[model samples]
Target: MAATKTRTIEQLVAEYAEPIADAVGLDVDDDDRTLSGFTRLLSDAADMLSPADCTREWLEDAAEALTALGYVDTDTARQAILARVDGLLYEAKSDLESC
Candidate 1:
């Protein structure tokens, strides 16, 4: 059997960034400021998520990155994070039910 390759978060992020953005209604032309900002935000989030250690520190960095990007306010970012977490938890629960 061939060995599996370990892909970095950055690589995966870069590959799916456009489609992910599109799903979230962020897909826009290259010249669009909103698209650029979202791309930068995605890159920052990927960097924060790429490490094995310092999970809390990485979350803090990610939160800062969200606000520093200047498109999303702190409250909005917090709400968004919570929303995603809730969605994931719901999905997990559904998966467990099926299992």
Candidate 2:
């Protein structure tokens, strides 16, 4: 039997960051920035989701990485990033729930 591949949140975030940034007309120089922004957004979202949620840790780690990378600051900026991330997360969750 072949092992199924499971993608880490970081990996998934890295994969989608640029397209997301571009979709919203945000200029992201690299995957790092996108990852950071995604992380910050995820962290904020995690607070609203239950601990049993898989996204909890992913969001927190991504936010921490973004903070370390100097990508996030100020409540307004953080909220903006979170809004975008949340949108993506919601879509993903909906898709998963339907499956």
Q: What TM-score fits each model?
A: 0.27, 0.34
The lDDT of model 2 is: 0.50
> For every model in order, what is the number of clashing pairs?
0, 2
Error of 1 at 76 (Å): 0.6
Model 1 TM-score, all chains together: 0.27
- Identify the leading candidate in terms of lDDT: 2
The Cα RMSD of model 2 versus the native structure comes to 11.6
lDDT of 1 by residue, 28-81 (tens): 444323434544644443353335534323333433443443465576564555
lDDT of 1 at 89: 29
Error of 1 at 42 (Å): 24
